[model samples]
Target: MSFGFFNIPAPVNEPVKEYRPGSPEREAVKQAIATFRSQEADIPMYIGNEEIRTNQKVRLAPPHDHQHTLGYFHEGTAEHVNKAINAALSAKDAWAALPWEHRANIFLKAADLLAGPYRARINAATMLGQSKNAYQAEIDSACELIDFLRFNAKYMAEIYAQQPNSASGVWNRLEYRPLEGFVFALTPFNFTAIAGNLPAAPAMLGNTIVWKPAYTQVLSANVFMEVLKEAGLPDGVINLIYVDGPVAGDIIFNHADFAGIHFTGSTKVFQTIWGEIGANIHKYKSYPRIVGETGGKDFVLVHETADADEVAVGLVRGAFEYQGQKCSAASRAYIPSNLWSAVESKVKQFLSEVKMGGVEDFTNFVNAVIDERAFKKISAYIDEAKKSDQVEIVAGGNYDGSKGYFIEPTVIKVQDPAYRTMCEEIFGPVLSVYVYEPSYFDSIIKTVDQTSEYALTGSIFAKDRYIIERVSKALENAAGNFYINDKPTGAVVGQQPFGGARASGTNDKAGSALNLYRWLSARTIKETYVPPRHFGYPFLEAE
Candidate 1:
């Protein structure tokens, strides 16, 4: 396997570790795992309505426990942005008129397509490009999205079609209709589900979409399109494009028919878009809907009586899963002073088993960051934390970018709760640890409220019901999706709608009825029946 950039060795023979449904693999298992490593996943640049495939140095998915050569994506131009928006606008009306049943059928077919031919390619891409372990890749590329499609379909059948009983004398009915415009779906890199499935939410409800996938996960997004097309989706019903944000925003905001933005990214960007829409509110024929799930400075509050083992496992997975790029990743862990030593010991024991390498190497625990910029940003933060007197680098602080964007899972003990590391959204593999006395729960909650600017997701670990309830109520503004005795990430689509208020997002839970309602506008239709032939309002004479 030669990449021309450097000399590469032949693929090694290693047994693929299989985990049954009930027994999930822990991140610690990467320590002793062995597997061949490769960095050859294809990167597809989707422009307008077509896929532009290239072998240019693009980031490859790293094996779960090993290192691999780095790759890069060729940048898209402004022309690509305009074309996709035009395609979506052109297809808006037709897609909007598509029957709910028909749309649901298309989505079902897409699910089948993904389950059949596209699964392997998607799995490989996820494992290689995103450095997801095989199990993790399967969860994102297979199980979760499949659940989304199936559940949303069922919701359409049960909830979306329910009819309200009307009065016998007055003949009237209410119909919920699709928003008559195009939806702009801007997705994140961490989840392929967001790239394809989020856009489908609006599309399934008779609205067309112009979706801009994250640059890092462009390959997976293209694969999703392939599945949809294979399912016989009408061309232009869902337009997939790969372009920079500013260019896409220009096209989305300037268009008279643009409906809304389904965004999952930074809060700064979300706020910027909100302001733009506000300024141009009067220009649009109809008010556009804005749904977003932005950055999260999620936390895990561990009570003194909490299970130390659970906290350790939860914290490790929360901080290092996908290198902590997920919106729901746990960035902070607040432990009670009495339990701090136990929690720290367990965390160290768990972290000790982590392996770091290329995407194809199955033994590697930490994978490469998406690109040089992300690597630089994370590395700079690590360097800054090293110099801070109020921060202590607890377990790991290694970084290697000579081959690719890679940073070790970092854990920092905050000397002061008000320190910059504890207060900000690092958005990397940086974990801040804080310890407080159990009696100071109220003050700790207040500190979380005052410090965190973003609140998308978080979790608390405690067996006591009263403590859990009190903490839950106290951290009301902490997040939209708060967990008890569990990790903040891995939200099930139907049961719990995922999003946050304040800086986190608009709190519109994707794949839920709440989200579906956003893509639709309600219309009231009234009809009157007369004994003979004349049926009209009092002002109109019988004819």
Candidate 2:
């Protein structure tokens, strides 16, 4: 099939012209890099209270032509993680003892740092390092962090200071306190917002944390730490380590002071961690909180009466944005057969307009996949889907890894919702569109719900209120954050508590009040002016 989707334009790769830094033609690039270098030169990585450097050189994204030069980070050794955790545990008590207002001020200052040129610098770095286009890079990096900083601090502060109810005759008040030990934050690479949420919420509530960002996005995570330090976040309140996952897991999971984990990644990893926590539940001083947002088999349900153009917009952005790397990216779309032609036409038109190229190019819409491994995975899925006799390639399904890790924004029409593409979390720019008979609407909806082990997010496009209500109620358990006529990937903080229950996640609710709750433990204190005048038991009264 041709790469073009309806009227959507194929990615036009107008190459960037090379020029010397000081040349007139290169002035903008020179300025951007200068701003980038100034902000990034002293970026700190907090290993507990200490800001340590490993002499590791941060590299920009290798040339698009140099596909063989895979970027790798200098991993934090096991010993390093142990030391960091020890420091976090040590600082927990003193950090937690600080007044809420003091902690809030630190976060607010950090927010200020995040909003300034520091954010732009970090965004530029993320763009160059991850090979993300201008919009994709900025959206996932700086903008999301701004959202997190503004909302999370305000929410946590408000909740922490909320007053307890007082009875007229009997005096009673409740107090919230931080959990006693260091928490672990394991984040993913897709969004910088996850980076902020995984650590800051807990830290805001007076809980110290050890954060291990995903290897693919370490540079952005490093930038975040630097911003935090500049904002005057106290040393040891949050720590960062660059270690292998299993090694970090061992250090954090087995430690005596390990109190909780905030994770966002694969379901298998989450289950493994959960199982380990179960095995060692008795070994811990107390129960440790495990919060995660795992894999998603997110879907977009299109009804017969839905707006075709609206659905098209949602599909294009939801399925192909970020190369469909997001957990909530719409992978499987269920459409009523009656409107299949119109919806398919519109989606095809939308896909054709998507332009993919280099991050530095302002006009490019999409860019490279994170790495070769991910690009290959997406290619394999497309190959598998193409081989099936039960599917048809509607628009695009192609990959050219000779240069950058690029894949066409793919679209496929499947005959059965039970097909592998429909059921699995492709986690790439491969959209599987399934047309269903009107009679099988309810049955198909049920089928879609059970298609995957995950239910992180889903959306429906329908103008009919009754239909919207019915489909929504039906897919209630299918997703944590459900949408109507809107893309699922962009979840606003405070308004939508982001995460899922069951296989999708551990119900951490990242952007909401519930996320802050995970960082604290409740303690009850009661006072009485007079002792019990008379005991119910005779022995007590005598005493």
Best by lDDT: 2
List candidate 1 segments past 4 Å from native.
1-76, 531-543
Angstrom error at residue 354, model 1: 1.2
Candidate 2 — which pairs collide? 5-348, 8-352, 8-353, 9-352, 9-353, 76-242
lDDT of 2 by residue, 1-543 (tens): 333212211212112233334554344433554454444344345776566666654433432333433243455678888888888877888888876767777776766675565656566667666666555655666656666666766676567566667665556765788886788999988787787778988888889888888766776777788778877777787888877889888877887678899899989999999999988887787799888889998899888778888888898999888788888899999888888888789877877877777666655667778777888888998998889898899988888888888888999998877888888777888889888887787787788788888888899898899989998888889899999989888776656778887688977787777778877788877667666776586665653
lDDT of 1 by residue, 1-543 (tens): 322222112212112235443333323223212221323334455444566554334454343322444344545556766776677777777767766677788888777676655665666566655666666666677666766676666665655556666565556665777776788888887787777778888787777788887776766676787788888778777877666789778767877887888888888988999998888888787889999989888988888779988999999988888788888889988899888888899989988999876644556667776667788888888899899887889988889877667789999998788777777777778899998989987788778777788888889899999989998888898789999999888787766788888889889887677888788787766665644465666778666
Whole-model Cα lDDT of every candidate shown, in order: 0.74, 0.76
**How well does candidate 2 score on lDDT at residue 471?**
87
TM-score of each: 0.86, 0.89
Give lDDT: candidate 1, residue 487.
87
lDDT of 2: 0.76
